[model samples]
Target: MKKIVSKKDIAHLDQRFRANFINSIEGFKALNLVGTIHSNGGTNLAPFNSIFHIGANPPLIGMVSRPDTVDRHTLENIRSTGQFTLNHVNETIYRKAHQSAARYDTNVSEFKAVGLNEQFINGFSAPFVQESKLKMGLELREIKTVELNGTYIIIGEIIHIEMATNKISEDGFVDIQQLGTITVAGLDAYYKTSLLERLPYAKPLM
Candidate 1:
């Protein structure tokens, strides 16, 4: 049976409930996942659910950063080094990734604390996580700030990409779901993924 949503249902709820409801409807199961911002100077900060790929040709990738009431280590590291790696979390580092979201002092390196092995290119000092099922190394491309909210969106050009050899198909598609990629639930919950169906692109009528 389908349950109908009526305005009266929300009207009776408290302000917090209403706000959370709106957030839940919009952002629930938002392909949310965690990634490590591998910074130069051997500093790696784990952050949750901030990954997005912007384009294909230039292979642009992006992530967002809100104001750090504490200290924004990821933002600062990227600004200084001009490079960062996005390491998608899997079953292995799930718990560690959540712990990284805490307001830790900038001096602490979450990478070491979390037991993530590091891989780095010689020219770039920022290290990439070897354990991630998928990872990308990006060079800083563009950054835009939302003036009203003071949040920043950082876009980078992908210079290198790495994936677990087993996850790629002979046809060249990355079977992320088959590889058991993780996703975010709400602010802190993590969920395993399952496939629903595949849809083809629409064709134009002659």
Candidate 2:
């Protein structure tokens, strides 16, 4: 028989253990490094897997941020300057991207500490990961606070996009498999992705 964990049992589990278990249960998540720059010019890079699309007409994306329980440089910088960049985690820079998750000091620049190059685009206040094959710049649109868990959900409008020409298909799909993008399971395990299959649009009576 397979093991089962009840809510009561899980409630009694160790804090970190419960976090790891719940995080991994969601399966593979897209790994991305969010880049931000403070007004003082300190840069921050943090890897987050919670980025999700909210709409296409406006090209909006939403990302979950843990409540201001700690000094989160990414969130603070985004609030200060209202801009940030999202960079896909590739196989070659997975290690460096993960390093950004560490709690670096407020004035510290993770790009400098982790050995990743920071790139700035015209008219943008945030920096992008130079080594990332796919990157996008965003301007903060709104912030929603989840009262239940004290989590913050920040929504941004896509302002700029950068990618290699060969990585995109004629139909507008980015071939992530060919891009060597990496996904994450739990908090530490990193993985490369492959296409399982591309299915046609579903029909009511297909």
Candidate 3:
């Protein structure tokens, strides 16, 4: 049986309860480690669950940055450098990836603090999580503010991709389940994935 929690109830709930409850209501979210480098050459790695593909034509991906009310190092660096990386969190590094969220001083590199390796290929400004099995290099396309909530939507165009060759299927679909990409619930819970049957494109009977 489902418990009914109305808007009124939600509004009256404890603050921390509301945070966890609201975030968890969405079921599962895609978790990735966003890597960036500050203008002073300080590197950062933070995990986020808000990444979504904006389009494939230009290979764009979008992610959300919470209100700038607090010090958001990732957002600041992306703006200054116009580059960042979206690296999928896998089973091996999920704990380290989660730990990267702890508020650290500006001079600290979460990549180093959390024991994850930082990788950079020529021409890409942002670092990549070398521990990640699947990673994408992105160039900033736009940053739009949400007038209602004060959050931000960052859109980026995928410029480069690196992954293990065997993870890709012959038809070109990247096998995420095989890659051990983890899905997150609420703030800290992580779950591994398994492949279900793939169905053909839906078509209506005439």
Number of backbone collisions per candidate, in order? 1, 0, 0
Model 3: per-residue lDDT, tens digit, 107-158?
Answer: 8899999999999999998999998989999999999999898889999999
Q: By lDDT, rank the candidates, best first.
A: 3, 2, 1
Tell me how far the alpha carbon of residue 191 in candidate 2 is from the true structure, in angstroms, after superposition. Answer: 0.8
lDDT of 3: 0.89
Report the lDDT tens digits of candidate 2 across residue range 1-206: 89998999999999999999999899988889999998988888999899898999799999989855322678888899999999999999999988888877787788998999999999998999999989999999998989999888999999899986555566778787677788999988998876799877788995
TM-score of each: 0.78, 0.95, 0.95
The RMSD (Cα, Å) of candidate 1 is 4.0
Greater lDDT among 1 and 2 belongs to 2
**Model 2: ten consecutive residues of lowest lDDT:** 66-75
Quote the lDDT for 90 in model 3: 90
Residue 19 C-alpha lDDT in model 3: 89
Taken over the whole model, the C-alpha lDDT of each candidate is 0.67, 0.88, 0.89
Off by more than 4 A, model 1 = 1-23, 28-42, 69-71, 166-172, 204-206
lDDT of 2: 0.88
Write candidate 1's Cα lDDT for 1-206 as tens digits.
87666898878889776756754565524232223343434475666465676898888877787765322567777777787877777776778767766676566667677766777766656677767777777798888998987988988888877777665655567877564567775556677777787666689878
lDDT at 90, model 2: 92
The stretch of ten residues in a row with the least summed lDDT in candidate 1 is 28-37
Model 3 misplaced stretches (Cα beyond 4 Å):
68-71
